[model samples]
Target: MTTTPPHTDPVMHAIGLAVTEARGGDPAAARRALLDLWERTGVTGDPLHRCALAHHLADLHEDPAEALVWDVRALDAADALTGARVREHHAALSIAGFYPSLHLNLADGHRRLGSFAAAARHIDAARAHSPALARDPYGDLVRGAVEEVADAIARRDRAPRAPAPGPAS
Candidate 1:
């Protein structure tokens, strides 16, 4: 049987394109595209779109402070999302699944910014929320990241992790 691709919203398509641009070595274009989409998404637009766009936008920033702002936006948007709403994009998605990665990013950013206490809090939160993940590659990936960031916090490492962020991030 031939399985069909899941239907996606235009905003998601645009977000994907912008991410692709960043991965394809045109971060300036990617930033512009995502920023324009952010304006379209507005402050109270679709929670899923806002969460996704903000998350990816954070990946594009090397500055911990700027990235922290976007990561916080992603986390906030995730809180506003619902399973029913996310199911519109992917039947397998859960808002609970979003927290591990969101908190991981925040933890990493805080660690980089010398906010070890906050980083520890977020890393612990990421671990606490990790059981919501499926035993798939995505789950494993986030779990690995949790460990990595936790170690960074423990060492009080205030440097950016190698392979910092981009399309692949």
Candidate 2:
């Protein structure tokens, strides 16, 4: 049975609290809490912390464009976590585990902005790098999100576009 390191639990708990607050209709408070956590982590903290912070922050933004910025940052931070870097915090950390969710979020963000091509690319990446853990709820969630985005894209494609206006008279 895999277990999260004791040291990482506090951070995870804090993130969960912030997420709950956001989902409970108090996004402003959630944003402030996440921002505070981000500030505490700074640039020199563990890559995992930065990745988590950026990922959660992305969800707080009402604008898809702005959310995409945070999603990209989360992916960057996750990608930068080498074995040595990850060992500093989570000795048994599987860096590959982060890619699926990060890519899934990016796909959703891109889809929201009507960037179907970019969204498809990220969706493929998510599928390719998905974690192999058994009964991982987060992985299931990512898979569901990928399907949702794909469906949205399909619906958009089937939508008829209005004719373009002629040049001014």
Candidate 3:
């Protein structure tokens, strides 16, 4: 038998309110609400709330590249954050896998920026992070997307580098 911490409920309720606001077309307000929740709950190390915050940040960004930064922050927050409060969240995500989504989104962002090497690196990270991604229901779509991007990066790399664009003749 297991029991949830008392603080967990409050944090979840606050996160839910933020998400509801974000989904209801007021992302800025949602972002503010989540930030307040972070401050109130001191949820820096709680993987669930950190992931939610990161997703909120990503959703608020106009640029995919900016969103990638938030995605990476989310991963880092999960990886480095420490506290008894987050143990269950970490354990659950470890069992479920979290890295592939981070790497795939990062790779997609890098691809959009024409950063082939970076894109490939993140794709490789995605693959390395979740070798059995194809077998995981939650990771399958990201895995497929990463495979396509990886293929595109390989093709791009094999092609000769074009002459740098200069002033028109």
TM-score for each candidate, following the candidate numbering: 0.92, 0.76, 0.65
List candidate 2 segments past 4 Å from native.
1-4, 7-13, 83-93, 131-133, 157-169
Candidate 2, 1-169: lDDT as tens digits: 3444635667656877887777777989989998998898886676777888898898778788888999998998887788665555555556777787788778777777778888889888887886543355555766666676667666654222221122110
* Worst 10 contiguous positions by lDDT, candidate 1: 1-10
Is candidate 1 or 2 superior in TM-score?
A: 1
Q: lDDT ranking from best to worst?
A: 1, 2, 3
lDDT of 1 by residue, 1-169 (tens): 2322333478888888888888888988998899999999998999988999999999889889999999999999999998888777777677899999999999999999999999999999999999999998778888988999899899988989764343342
In model 2, the number of clashes is 0
**Any residue pairs clashing in model 3, and if so which?**
none
As for TM-score, the candidate ahead, 2 or 3, is: 2
lDDT of 3 by residue, 1-169 (tens): 2546434566666676776776677878987887776576454556666765775566566676786777777777657654454455333334225677677767766776678888888989888887645475456666766787687676764322222122110
Q: Kindly report which residue pairs in candidate 2 clash with one another.
A: none
Best candidate (score: lDDT): 1
- The lDDT for every candidate, in the order shown, is 0.88, 0.73, 0.64
